[model samples]
Target: MTLPLRILMPLLFWALGLAHAVAAEPSGKVLRVLAWPGYADPEVLQGFSQRTGARVELTVVGSDEAMRQRLLSGRGRDFDVFALNTAELQQYIDQGIARPIELQRVPNTRRQRPRFRELSAIPGLIRRVDGLTQVYGVPYTYSEMGLIYDRRQLSAPPDSLQVLWDPRWRGKVLAYAGGTHNFSLAALALGWQQPFELGERQWAPAVDKLVALRRNVLGFYSLPEESVQLFMRHKVALMYANYGLQQLHLLKAAGVDVGYVIPREGALAWLDCWAISSSTGDPELAHAWINFMLEEPASSLLVSRQGLANTVSDSVASAPQVPLRWLEPVESEERREHYWARIHSGDSPSRVLQR
Candidate 1:
């Protein structure tokens, strides 16, 4: 239960007064930030706190599922701001877990590249709520989910998504464990153009493809760090690089001789954005954090240290020049998750289709 402002004010002032001598006095505001690993660096958080006089509390989530669970578990009250991909932003908007961003408060967005400046041009960033169309997310970073292969095992880089299931490399491949994305990847491998929208007829085949993928892979991994550990420990020949260049940078740092490529079918890419939580008590501080992330040092650090492309600057790293299928809202996220669980749990194809 929230205390009345009259009582809360006196308590807050008393607490801050007691600590002012030992620590730099803060503005009595705290900004809670929940984001993926590497998105909020220590230096960046320190800079934001120092500049704004707001205390920062950060939480790092590794997978999309984990992020969703956190946001929903607390009804968006756990954090004031969060980062999620464009593909996943719509559900939050529809559920009212995310609130419309006040762009006027986030002035740094003006410094973003032209493509990101016009939020409406990109899909899933806005929606009409009660006759009012409002913007909900701001683009921050992006990357393509390409394939990473070991140069020592394959003479040349594999050109297609089908290579993930090649019998010859059975038990030598590492794939992502996400449900919706794995289903979409399976759709692509089956030569379906609309990977996100699977028809009734497309469901069985996608299930079969995922079952095959489960059988052929060394194992499935959810986080980039876990994937790298599995890849190096198993001497994995090929991997579905769900984390894209970020994974590549980790492996390269560990001196792994690997090559990254976009398959012939095209790679799935995601543009992650920072969004304000609907339950936030301090919307201004949340907006300040979002704008602070767009500064040169923070944006450049993403490219140099995390190997991700920032919205404000051109990346120094080499991203492949190939067609990319940016992720979109899937037809049925729940259906995909239900089936993916059975498939990943070692269920036989016939048994998996029983439902």
Candidate 2:
């Protein structure tokens, strides 16, 4: 007494359709994202998800170049959001990979700090061949290269970059090996005028100084976690690191004794921003996530947990230690290019490996 085949098939189809109708409904849904290690933590994502029912998938990337390669490989749309440093965004905008952000749709945009808005939304920051203005990114955090040292190893922290080459500190210092950010900051401490605006003539002396320092370096580290680990293990006494607050918090939590100092010459500041992929299919979801991140509560959590400044104004009240001026817009491309070329010449062997 089984039911007829046609009737059973139709009933089964109806049941399946009903089940899909119930399951496909989403309160909030987000796609994958690429970001730096400490930029977003599990609790931060959980808070957003709990509030909006949106699920966030995060992929940690170490460098801007790695993010670029991932996006350019034709799967850019796989992620609804990605984080890029301001310098990296310049290249992304030039390549037409980043889509313009419509702040009007995200009301929380008003919550962002004035400096963050001024830097990211500035008209000429990312110029295009067309006359249209493209605001393609939103800054999340700002960092400056500084010295991270072991309080137990050094009675007094070095005051300037020159100590990197001192015979006493030789084989006890570490630095970033991949980019010119740390090197450029070090050059500034060495009396290089206009540290971020070097010319060919200005580079020779900088290279010589860097080469000498490289000779004395314990090793070059490519990742912050590794850098911290080295310090924890007493592998090196001092290293060039991003703003100390974040690392300092982690080290303290791990029961490691460390301290950070901003050299007298000042430091090279960098801003990391979030941008939607031009290829993203779910723009609404992406916009929602960005807006969610800008909300006061979420922003506060980000600052308190990660030691990164939220881009919005309200976030600043909780993160007063983050210097607002560091978010200032970079100089013209011509000037940046001049410095970029000199610092990235690839001619010096010392630049290849920090001995």
Candidate 3:
């Protein structure tokens, strides 16, 4: 589909003509795709459109939580396919929100890396639902939540997540505004390996960590672009990079000199995959969207442009040996969200955890 420019240009004009003609009289169905910003590039969507004569409606999600809200809000039938991390995918499967993908339909799974190809072996990627184990998602893009520091502010890179708590960087540090990720990060910073399974005892320390972060940071940001803008506008010395390498790329491209590091305690990461909606009108078309994403141009753009690691290529900068703890379905998302709201609103840890 990625033809040479000389060849692609003529085809582009012809495709445009065809599109205009088709606009008068539609033929193929619309495949709605729910994914992050860089996943559904205009060129890739257009390529898929030209190839199958199908229209793709892409909706970009700012966070994994937002994607969850949208999917559950509609009983999973609102969209044909959605991009979600393995953890969220599991919840969808349990709730009967996702449909099992037929291996025969998604031939691109064969083109994935050795680790990804053996989906059954990977933890959380495959799970038993209703007494039958099934594959849920097609692994697409992934990243770790590392630390970022301004080169001019820090003589050397930070070696631990504790730096974000340093009083010296008070009102100059940046942290993700989301409750779920912040809670996981606080648990990890506290040396709790099982971040997703925090008990009552773990709640106090985690809440304290979040309260401290809120007190230290000038203001928390929710999106990668927002983080970039905040860093440039403020004298940001340190940051808890929620988007990891993707944020680093955006900052550098905007001429901000920053350094990224995985702390001694390691980093929290997410493996985002494409999943079919239970309410898909055309499973074949939905499968085609996932398959198209694995192709050369789409996979390469994820690395070269967004800095996220793709399943098919090794060209991007990936810290393979660096330890990463993948996100998982937590004990109670509702409880975490409730407490997190209070923590953000300046409630004392003791008062916040009183419940």
lDDT of 2 by residue, 1-355 (tens): 0001101111233222221111122665656677665455555566666766666777655444556667878647657788776666766676767888877767776767676666434432444448765677776765556677788888997677666677887888887654345445545766665555656565556556666666777876655566667767655788776544555555666787777766666666666677888887788778877777776565665566655556664432123343322323333444433433444453464443232
lDDT (10s digit) by residue, model 3, range 1-355: 0001101121333322222212212555888777666676678887888877887776655555567777999988778999877877777888888988877888888888876787765457776769986777888987788898999999999989999999989999999877887888999889987887889788888998999888988888876778889999997999888878878888888899898888988888878888999899999989888888899789988777667788886524455566678777788888888999999999998889877
lDDT of each: 0.81, 0.59, 0.78
Off by over 4 Å in 1: 1-25, 61-78, 129-132, 279-281, 316-323, 326-329, 341-348
Off by over 4 Å in 3: 1-30, 53-78, 118-123, 129-132, 315-317
- Error of model 3, residue 153, in angstroms: 2.0
Q: What residue pairs clash in candidate 3, if any at all?
A: none
Model 2 lDDT at residue 304: 66
TM-score per candidate, chains pooled: 0.79, 0.69, 0.80
> Arrange candidates by TM-score, highest first: which order?
3, 1, 2
- Model 2: which ten-residue window has the lowest total lDDT? 1-10
Tell me how many clashing residue pairs each candidate has: 0, 4, 0
Name the candidate, 2 or 3, with the larger lDDT value.
3
